[model samples]
Target: MTQIIRTSADLRDRVAAWKRSGILVGVVPTMGALHDGHMSLVREARKQSDRVIVTIFVNPMQFNNASDLDKYPRDEAHDLAMLEAEGVDVLFAPGVNEVYPDGFATKVSVSGISEPLEGAFRPGHFDGVATVVSKLFGMTQAGRAFFGEKDWQQLQVVRRLVEDLNIPIRIIGCPTIREPDGLAMSSRNVRLSEAERAQAPALHRIMTAAAEQIRAGAPIETALEQAKAEILAAGFHDIEYLEVRSVEGLRPMETFSEPGRMLVAAYLGDVRLIDNIAV
Candidate 1:
């Protein structure tokens, strides 16, 4: 039976017992509304470690829009049931006050790579990401942590945090799990209206095609400009960015001499979708 832990002391006690027994631990951090994409991480953790801890906290600090934060999907009972089926050892579902209580004053900020992309569009986003993630690292204290590559830039930011802060856990990035039509799986996808959902796969489709053309010798700027046009034509509004960038720093790339990535974020009606592909 999977254990449901809601307090840091209870979690640390369980972790201590696992430590004493020399069992390796892996943790998957999530904001609930469990889906197959989140399960993929749990499965990977199960495969690699003796114990798996799945955290279900919708970190309020990360949302740029207060309404967006309020609307973020959360179904903990469903999430817990899914984890139980996956053989997760513990479900760390802490209250917001537990994670960020009164007198909480510290924030973790990673400069440079985080300043662009999502950071540029969603101000203070990565600071929230870095802060809560750093706290997760401390709270779970697992030997390994799993993150999905769908949030490619976020992965780099976490990796930088682990290295720069000398955090002991190994950050393992799993390949993005996508829907049959290629829409990247996200908790927010649940809010997409049916019409928006049908049109959502185009984001991935366009990015994939753009990456192929760029790889096949198309000019980088031209490929990106065409992608923006395609997204706009597809009825996406508030198109935040569509550019090819160096995978490491997210710096825009004009020449595709080395491996690079094409990242995009646009709104399909009210739902914002982001996707990336290799070039």
Candidate 2:
């Protein structure tokens, strides 16, 4: 059985015991509504560390839209079953007050890399992520943290935050897990209508096709524009951004580069889908 530990104090005590045992700890921070994508991170943590802790607290500060936050899926019973099946050692499901007490004033914000894409589209989203993640690291006192690359930018932000602040934790990035149809798995995907669900995989298809084209010497802007048009045609109405950017620093790329990735964020019905592929 996986132990469910809440409250930072209880977490500190358990982590202290592990510290005494001299075992390496890995933390997988998630928003609950556990999916195979999140399990993939737990799997990686299990392999890489002696002990694993998965945090399930959908931090309210991370959601820019109140409704989106309100609608974010959560089922602790189901999540715990999945974590137990995965052999996770502990599941830290903290309450809002446990994680964010009254008069929580500090906010962690990363500049430069966080400015474009999701940051620009969802104002202050990364700040919320950074702050909560920082708190998670402190609470778990884990030596390594695992995050999936499905959220490429968010992964980068966490990496930057850990390094900039000298948090003394190793950040391990796991590859993105996707459906057989190629749609990146996300909690929000469940909200898509049946028709929208059918069209969702096209986002991944477009990024892959665009990546190949760019690699084959096609003009970056031309490939991206064509991808944007195709996404709209595929029934994604709000094509927020479709860009090819450097893997590091996330600088926009207009030409072939060794470490570049093609990223897209579009909406199907009301569900927002984001997918990225290496270029």
Candidate 3:
């Protein structure tokens, strides 16, 4: 039975009152289609703070394709039920008008790290993520915020933004949740037809294999090529990008760096899926 705060003013008022009463708040930001991955974040937030705030905003600014934004799933009633069951204390579900009333005149963009891989695929995507996240951090005044490690690069960008902007909230990255078949749990998974869902696990499987190859002293270029071959052979129509980068700064690597990650994005039919595995 968590209260839903749909406006910035209401969120600030509640958070300010909570602060006066010494209540520590934790936040989980999402784009409305709540799944097990999102619930995991809420549960983690519940463990660390007196109250948990879950924001459901599709964030139009983050989409490079207008159709992608239009096609994003949204079910407020179902999402609210899931949040309530997970013990979330507040649901900040705002309309686009409320969150970006000025038609997005300004945005937050990070240099260096924001211009590669996912950034290259969807231009200005991180800018939208950073801007909306900054607004959420300010509105909720969260003592801590929870994010999934599935979007590892995006998590890093947020971490940098928090540090550079001197935001007081502690950002915690939760582990990536996955299906029994090993496919990373995602809201977009719903868009996959039955056969596509069965084939989607190949992305994770390939990344896992690539990580093993790197650990076994295989050449980075050869391992990546093998991984790409594996995915392509598994019926992935388009391989957007598959790369191994240093975990610290997400820079591309020519050799295995001991501790890094394999990042992959592919299109199965029309649905775009992304996944990563640590090396």
Candidate 4:
């Protein structure tokens, strides 16, 4: 059974005991909607550390749109069951108040890497991510952290955050898990309507093909334009962005580079889906 921790003090005490015993703790931070993608991170954590902690906090600060925040899928009972089954040592599902007390006034913001793509579309988002992630690191005091590569830009931002701040925790990025149909698994997928869900896998298919084209010597802009057109015709409401960027600095790349990642963000009905792959 996974111990559910809801307060900072209690989590600190528990981590202290583990540290005293020379146990290396690992943490998987999440937003309370556990899918196979999240489970993959937990499994990696279990394999890499003596103990594992999975945090489920639907951070209010990260959502630029209020409705999106309210609509974010959250089922603590189900999430806890999944963690317990994975042998997670703790679930730090803190309430908003617990994470951001009334007097809270600090924010962690990473510049440059965070100013494009998702950041450009969703304003002030990474500030919230950085702040909460830093808080989780301080609260859990884990030796390592796990994140999915599906949010490629996010992984980069968190990496930059850890390095810039000199945070002690090591950030481990796992591969993006996909469904049988090739659509990347995300907590927000539950909100996709039947028809929309049926058409959603095109995002991955189209991006994969485009990445291959770039690798095969096709022009980057030409491939992106074709992909955007295909995505729109595939029943997506809108294509916010579809481009290749440097894997490390996340700089927009017009020509194929040695290490690049192709990322996309499209809307299906009211749900916004993001996916990425190596180019």
Candidate 5:
């Protein structure tokens, strides 16, 4: 059976002990809603490390709206059972009080790149993400960390964080897991109603259409404008952003380039969904 650890101090001591023995540690950070998407990360970690430590904490700092934070899913018993089945080695689950003992007065912030796209929509989301991820890397002392490309911007921010701070951890990005209809799997996906769920695939369709346009030598602006129009016409309430960025720099593109990313976010009712594709 995998060890279930619920306190920070115990996780610290156990990881520290593993470090002295020179064992490879892998960390997978997540909130406590275990899905197949999350299991992909856990399995990847288990394959690569001598021990895998998965941290399940719903981070309050990441949510700008109180309702969104309050409504975020929680199924601790199910989450633990899923992790144990995936051959997870250790689970580092800490309470909000345990994670932010000082009440989150300190935070991590990345400049420039974060202000565009999703960051523009949710003010301090990345700051919360960066802070919590930094703490996870420290607590686990992981040699490698796993993330999904579904949150491509987040993966980029974390990659930059590790590089800039000289944190000795390798980031392994797994491919985005998707529903059969192509909607990327997310904890937030549960919020969609049957009708809303039917419309959810529009986000993925938009990006796939953009990729085809880019492949056909269309201009970047033309592709984005067409995709935005299609999404709005399909009845999505608000289009937050549709950006084609250099995969390396995450900057707005003047022209479409192969091996780039097309990122889109839209609101259906009040639930926001993001999807991206490589072109």
Candidate 6:
């Protein structure tokens, strides 16, 4: 059974006791639509630490669109069952007021790396991510934190946050978990229509193919342009971006002289899907 701690003060006390006993803590932060992708992170946390705390708060601060926030999936009972099966120590599912209480005026912002890709398409998104993630770090006081590499840019922003702010926690990035057909698992996947769901896997399939081309010395722009056209033709409604960038700084890569990543954001109807691959 997992202990459900709904407030920061309670979580701190629990963490304090764990630390007093010299138990290493690990945390997996998420919004509550638990799927295999999220479970993979929990399993890693469990293996790497003495205790694990999985936080599930749909942070409203991160949403640029009010309707998108409202539509975000959440199921506490189902999520709890999954956490229990994973033997998670705590489910830090706090309310909005609990995380951002009255008079809470602070915000955590990481610039540069956060200004492109998802950040450009979704404004003020990473600020909410940084703010909530920093608060979670402080609240959990865990020695290690696990994040999925599916959100590669997000992993970078968080790594930068911990380094710049000197927060004492190790950030571990696990590989992106995908379905057999190759669609990356996401909470938003639930919103896709039956037809859209079938078309969604093409994002990964096409991105992977483009990445291989870039590696084989195809002109970066030509490869990306073809990928975008193919994705739109493959039944996607629109493409936000299909770009090759440096894995470190996320700077646009023209020649692929260094290690790069192929990242794409395409829409299958109103549900925008994002995926990335190594190049």
> Where does the lowest 10-residue lDDT sum fall in candidate 5?
251-260
- Against the true structure, candidate 5 reaches a TM-score of 0.96
Candidate 3, 1-279: lDDT as tens digits: 889988999899989999999999999999989999999999999999999999999998899999999999989999999998998889999999998997568788898888888999999899999999999999899999999999999999999999999999999999999999999999999999999999999889888988888889999899999889989999897898999898869988897765887888899989999998898
lDDT of 1 by residue, 1-279 (tens): 899999998999989888999989999999899899999999999999999999999898999999888988988888888999999999999999999889999999999999988999999999999999999989888999999988999999999999999998999999888999999999989999998899899889888988899899999889888988887888788889888899888887888987898888899878788888777
Error in Å for residue 105 of model 6? 0.5
Q: Please identify which of the two predictions, 1 or 3, would achieve the higher lDDT against the true structure.
A: 3
lDDT of 2 by residue, 1-279 (tens): 799998899999999999999999999999999999999999999999999999999999889999889889889999999999999999999999988889889999999999999999999999999999999999999999999999999999999999999999999999999999998999998888888889888888988988888899999999988988888998888888989899978998777766798887887887777888899
TM-score of every candidate relative to the true structure: 0.98, 0.98, 0.98, 0.99, 0.96, 0.99
lDDT against true structure, model 1: 0.90
Tell how far residue 173 is off in model 4, in angstroms.
0.3
Model 2 CA deviation exceeding 4 Å by range: none
What is the TM-score of candidate 6? 0.99
Model 1 misses residue 212 by how many Å? 0.9
RMSD of each: 0.9, 0.8, 0.9, 0.7, 1.3, 0.7
Residue-level lDDT of model 5, residues 26-86, one tens digit each, is 9999987879999999889989999999899999989998999999989888999998898
Please list the residue runs of candidate 1 whose C-alpha ends up more than 4 Å from where it truly belongs after superposition: none
Clashing pairs in 4: none
